[model samples]
Target: MKERWELMDDSKIVQLYWDRNEQALTATSDKYGNYCITIAKNILGNKEDAEECVNDTYMRAWNSLPPHRPNILSTYLGKITRNLSFNLYKRNTADKRGGGEVPVVLDEIVDLVSDTDDVEKEIDRRELVKAIDDFLGKLPADKRSIFICRYWYFDSISNIASRFGMTNNYVSVLLNRLRLKLHNYLLERGFEI
Candidate 1:
C-alpha cells in the first residue's frame, strides 16, 4: 500500500498536525526520518540515542504546531533533533562518551567571543540573541550560510568547503574572518566581549 501523505507537500503535512491529525506524525517521519536521524547521529554518535531523539522531535512538533507553524519544517525538526541529541549526549557522558563534529565545532568558536567576568551584567541573553541575529542579517548570504552550517548544523569545515566548492583552508579562513567580524560587532554593541 502506498502512503498517501508521502505524496503530500510539507505545508500539507504541517497542516495535518495543526488539525490534530495523527497521520501528521507518520507523514513527517516518512519525509524526514532519515534526515533527522542523521543530524542526531552526527551529534550523539549513537544509533539508539539518535533514534530516541528523532522520536522526541515528532512529539515536540506535535505539541508546538498549533501555536507555532514553521515556515521551514525540515529546519525546525532538525533543530529540535539536534537539541535533544545534545541533551541526551550530556546526560550519557558519565556512562559513555560519543564523539563526532561537536568537539571540533566547539573548538572552532572557542575564542570567537572574549570571556567576560559578567556577560549578563553587560547584555541580557535576549539582547545578545538579538545582536547576533542582527549581525547575521547584515552578513552576505554565503557567509551567513557558512556560519549557520558550521555552528547550527555542526558541519565540518571539509563538508562546508565541499558544499561551496572551496578548499578546506579557504573555508577555515572565511569562517575565522567571519568570527572576527562577529566579535568586533559584539564589542561595538557594548557586549563586553
Candidate 2:
C-alpha cells in the first residue's frame, strides 16, 4: 500500500512547495527518494553517500522551487540528483583512485567527451545537447537504449547485456560502435572533436 504522500501527483507536490508546506518534502521524498538514491548509488557506489546526495537534492529542489516550477518534476529532480552525485564522486575521488562502475563508465565514454576546458564547456552547451539528442533520435532503438543505459544510467556492461538479452561482449562491442557513431555525429555538427 502506498502512503498518502506517495499518492499525490507531481503537480500537487510542486504546488505544495509553492504553497510553502513542509509536507512537500515528505511527499517528494516518498515519491522519488529511492529513484534518486539509486541514481546516486550507481554513480558513487556507496549507500551512505547516495542517501546524503538525495537529501541534498531535496534541499536544492526546495530552494529552487516557489520561483522555478519545473515542467517535469522527476527530470528536474533527477538532473539535480545526478549533478550532485557526480560532484560528490569527483570530490571523493580527487586525491584517491575512484572506485566502482562510474570510472569504468567514464572510461568507456572517454572518446566521446572532450577533455580540454574549452571543449568541455562546448560539450555542456545547449547546442551540443541538441545535436546529441538528434543523433540519439536517429539511432536504432536498441542502440539508443544501450547508449543511454551505459552513459546516462551508468549500468554495467553485464547488467545492460542481461537487460537486453545480449552477450556481454556483444554489448561492449555495440557500445564502442555507438560511441564512434556519436563522436562522428557531433563532429559533423561543427562541434570540436
Candidate 3:
C-alpha cells in the first residue's frame, strides 16, 4: 500500500512547501528519507551519521524552498544528503582511519577530477562541472549509470557489479578506463588537467 505522501506527486509536495505547509516536511520525509539516507550512508558508512545528515537535508530543503524551487525534488534532496555526508566523512576521516568504500572511491577519480588547485577556482568550477556533465551525457547508458553509481551515489563496487551483472575485476577495470576517458575528455575541452 502506498503512503499518503507517496500518493502526492513531487509537484504537489513542492506546492505544499510553497504554501508553507509544515506537512510538506512529513511528505518529503516519507518519500525521500530512505533515498537520502542511502546516499548519505554510501558516503558515511554510519547509519546514525547518515540519518543525521538526512535530517539536515530536510532542514536545508525546508530553508531553500522559500526562494528556490527544484524541478526534481529527489535530485535536490539527494545532492544535499550527499554533500552533508561527504562533509561528515571528511571530518571523521581527518586522520584517515575509517573503513569504507568512500575513501577508495574518491581516490580513484580525485586526480582525474582535479590534478591541481584549478578545481577550486569558482569560475572554472562551474564550467568544468558543465563539461563533465556533457561528457557523461555523451557516454553510453551503462557507462554513465556506472559512473554516477560510483561517484554520485558512492556505491560499492560489488553493488554496481551485481546490479550490472559484471565481474568485480571488470567493474574496476571499466571504471579505471572511464576515469581515463574523463580525463582526456576534460583535457580536450580545455580544462587544465
Candidate 4:
C-alpha cells in the first residue's frame, strides 16, 4: 500500500495530527513508523527501547504539530526517534557504568577532530550534506546501506555484520575501506582534514 501521509500535504497531515484524529495516527504510522523504528533500533540496539522510541516519536509529533509545521515530517519524526533512543541508551549505559557501541563509533570520529574548533563553521553544513549524499549515491545499494549502518547509524561492526548477514571481519574491512574513501573524498573537496 502507498503511504497515505506522503500522499497528503504536510499541512493536512499537521492538521490531522493536531486534531488527534485516529486515522491520521494510523496513516502516519503506516508511512513513517518502520523508518523511525529502524533509526531507533540502529541507535538503541534493543527492540524494546526502539519500540518505545517509535511510540514516543508519534506522541511528540502529535503534540508538536500544532506549533511546528515541519517541512519534512518523516525526517522530523526520525530525528526525534533517534534522539530519544540515544538518550535512553545513554541513561542505560550510565546506570550500568558501561559505554555502548554507539558511543564507541562516535569516539572514532571525535578523536579525529579538534575539540575547540567549530567544525560546522569550517564547511557549510548544506555543502557537507550534499557531498555526503553524492558520495552515498555513487555507492552500490548494499555498500551504501553498510556505510550508513556503520557510520550514520553508529551501529557496531558486529551488529552491522549480523544485520547484513556478513562476518564481523568483513564488516570491519568494508567500513575501514569506506572510511578511507570518504576521508579522501572530503580532502579532495578541500575540507580540512
Q: Candidate 2 on 1-193: residue-level lDDT in tens?
A: 7559877889999999999899989999999998888788889888888899999999998998979999899899989999999999999899574455798987776766564668758656777788889999998898998888888877788889999999999999998888888888888877776
List the lowest-lDDT window of 10 residues for candidate 1: 112-121
Model 4, TM vs. native: 0.68
Q: List the residue pairs that clash in candidate 3.
A: none
Best by TM-score: 3
Local lDDT at 182 for model 4: 78
Candidate number with greatest lDDT = 3
TM-score of each: 0.84, 0.87, 0.89, 0.68
Q: Provide the lDDT at 116 for model 1.
A: 50
Point out the worst 10-residue segment of candidate 3 by lDDT.
Answer: 111-120
Q: Which model, 3 or 4, shows the larger TM-score?
A: 3
Question: Which model is ahead, 1 or 3, in terms of lDDT?
Answer: 3
Q: Runs in model 1 with CA error above 4 Å?
A: 1-7, 112-123
* lDDT (C-alpha, whole model) for all candidates: 0.86, 0.86, 0.87, 0.76
Give candidate 4 misplaced runs (Cα > 4 Å).
1-15, 26-38, 45-52, 66-75, 87-99, 111-124
